[model samples]
Target: MEFDASHSSSSLGARVVLIPLEGKVIRYAFKLEFQNTNNTAEYEALLLGLVEVKKLHIKMLKVKGDAELIVKQVRGLFAIKNERLRHYRNHVWDKIEAFNSFSIEAVLREFNSKADSLVVYAALLVPHPDFTTNTYRVELVYRLSIPDNFESWQVLENDK
Candidate 1:
């Protein structure tokens, strides 16, 4: 699975490409209507991909993304100091533990170009008249995958 994300003053978006060990590749992109940082958007991308993988009953997964910070934090190479980031990391780890086997790596942006472009396209919200594929999909998400606060939204902060 490959994932990437983009964030702007107006929106947050993410894309995921699921490459089965043997089968067709699946591509997914989503535009987030809520407020979130680029790091959270990266986590959202992975979370969305993991949900789809779980639905397909896939036991083993190798995830690749261009978000170096997120990848290193997930691998325990970087310390998560912020409360919100710690929450996101813990949530990601919980999902990873459910798999029989899981690995995540950080790749160069060029290597993750497909997902990166998909995210940009989704964020732009321009219709692709040439799009005629059943394997690719874009969706609009009205909420965050992980809430700003575990207990309540009242505690939300400007983590960015």
Candidate 2:
């Protein structure tokens, strides 16, 4: 699943999508953007997917993403220092706690290419060229490498 949140001509919008390798492309929600940071947008994507999973009564998820920061944050390694991100992190943690079982993992961008493509396509709908954007969480899946789980800060190996 993925999401791209931003504004188009002074409107608050968000898009929430989830893609399962085994099933259909689930579009949970979509909007232009709201008052949100990229970190918040990323958390929304994960939370939206979790919402669907809850509705479906499914448990035990191996959620994959390309964002090292988000993956690390979710894994309890990186601290959410920003006041803005703290809220999102807390929101995501709440959704995670609702689940029976789940694990967030970093994956190669190649594995998340389709969702990244969705972000680019979503960008085209906005009317304003200079609108504040928050596509980070979804598109960033293409930048992560194999992770090192050796230590507490080892959510990723060679993260740039």
Candidate 3:
């Protein structure tokens, strides 16, 4: 799995691209509805990627991302100072526990272009009524808009 995050003035977006050992590529894009820092968005992207891997019942997995902070934190080389990050870190650990073997590495952005493009695409997406679909294997974009105080955001799914 590869992950990336994009941030704008008013919103954040995350994307995860999964390439199974069988060589099938699947992409997931998300627009975060809440206010979050760049690090938070990175963590969110990592967590979302883990969730996707877990759903596949994969016993062993390797994750890659361009976020050095998140990679270091997950490897225990950096400390999580922010309270929100601590929560996200815990969630990441929990999801990772589901896998029998898991490892995450930080790679340069140039090497992670697929995930990077997914994030950029998510950030630029505008919701429209004409988009509606529920196909799992195709490229999926989730446009989520929520209030700053909202506890949960609804995912609007579209196929691309």
Candidate 4:
């Protein structure tokens, strides 16, 4: 599926992207935070996208965004300078490399406004969950319990 997101940066306007990841669409959500710059937020979106997509166990992905600086940085065309962004950038790189293959492309603002709006809306949403890792809507509603001592050996012996 191709997921597009755009984040409003208040002082700097908004940033957005489209990401394609193969999966069951079991989960979907976004997070907004205080950051040093808009570029960082854009990269953070991609990083978060990859991390969450990985949790879905998908093998391929394509990331699209309107932030040219972020796409360039991720593609190695630009050097990351901010100390905080450096860590976030590295984290995103690690997530991207974990996949068998991934790509990032720069999109025009005209094409990414909706996603950019999502970013801003997410940032301002109230009554939001507090967890750092995103979750599926189904996962959030279901409750599962497992016994403390249900070992495989026990199951094998029970078969007899």
Candidate 5:
């Protein structure tokens, strides 16, 4: 899964792209209807992707995001001092347990361009009626080589 978040004057949006082993690609872009911070929006995108992946009974998952702090927190490296973020982290952990294997890494924005583009579009566009149908459906919606137990900050090993 590749996730990204964007905020406009009045809305927060998230986008996720899921590519399964079967080679089918699914994409999701949704506007957050509630008040949220960028961190929360990032988590929302991840949570949404996890939910859909669980529904599909995917056994393994690789999560990629441009949010460094959130990725580190989920990896148990950073201390989550905020209660809200702690809660989000707990939720992420809960979802992660359903998978046989999981790995998450922080990625540069340019590498996550598709989801990033969807986030900007979601934040700014007035969607057509068909968009809602496209947004929530199960039919909708990369690899970073950072080691699972790495101790320090690691740069992305591959860009494409």
Candidate 6:
């Protein structure tokens, strides 16, 4: 798995790419409405990646990121000084404990390009008016109440 984050003046973007040993790839992107530093954004991406792994019932994982500080801290080689960083570290630990085995490594940004591109894509996403329809129409937006429950949302054509 690889993760990355990008920040703009108005928003923060985070993304993670998971590649299993079987060679399948999964990607996630998120846009944060709040302001955050680059390091904080990296932490958010890491946390989001871990959550996705847990949801997939992955027992072991090797995580790679370009953030040296986060990689070292997660590996217990560096100390977290900032209070906010400490909190993020604690959350990372909590999620890691659920895994049977977990390892993290810092890699050059060049090798982490997929995750980097995802972050850039997320950063560029902007909400705009839906011009496809000339008539204004009310559409029901449905969301699953339970997070990470993809199976619950599957619909058969007949049911729809």
Q: TM-scores for all candidates? A: 0.89, 0.61, 0.77, 0.60, 0.78, 0.77
Residue pairs in collision within model 3: none
Clash number for every model?
0, 14, 0, 6, 2, 0
Predicted structure with the largest TM-score when compared to the true one: 1
In candidate 2, position 19 carries an lDDT of 56
| Candidate that beats the other on TM-score, 1 or 4, i.e. the better one | 1
Candidate with best lDDT: 1
Model 6 C-alpha lDDT per residue in residues 28-101, reported as the tens digit of each score: 77775565788878988898788778889999999999999999988889998986676677668878999898
Residues 1-160, model 1: lDDT tens digits:
9999889997778889898778888888888887788888888888888888888888999999999999999999999887778788877897888899999999999999778778887777654343446868888888777775576642553341
- Name the regions of candidate 4 deviating beyond 4 angstroms: 1-35, 126-160
lDDT of 4: 0.52
Distance (Å) between predicted and true CA of 87, model 4? 2.1
Q: What TM-score would you give candidate 5 relative to the actual structure?
A: 0.78
| Better by TM-score, candidate 5 or 1 | 1
For residue 101, model 1's alpha carbon misses the true position, in angstroms, by 0.8
lDDT of 5 by residue, 1-160 (tens): 8988886668677888897778657777776666677887788888888877888888989999999999999999999898668777877897898889999999999999868877766665555233555443311221111123332322332331
Top-down TM-score ranking: 1, 5, 3, 6, 2, 4
| lDDT digits (tens) for residues 14-88 of candidate 2 | 344555668655543334333445555566556656666778776666777667687788888998887555555
Give the lDDT of residue 10 in candidate 2. Answer: 44
lDDT of each: 0.83, 0.54, 0.73, 0.52, 0.75, 0.74
Query: Order of all candidates by lDDT, from best down to worst?
Result: 1, 5, 6, 3, 2, 4
Candidate 3 residue runs with Cα over 4 Å from true position = 126-160
In angstroms, the error of model 3 at 26 is 0.5
Better of 2 and 5 by lDDT: 5
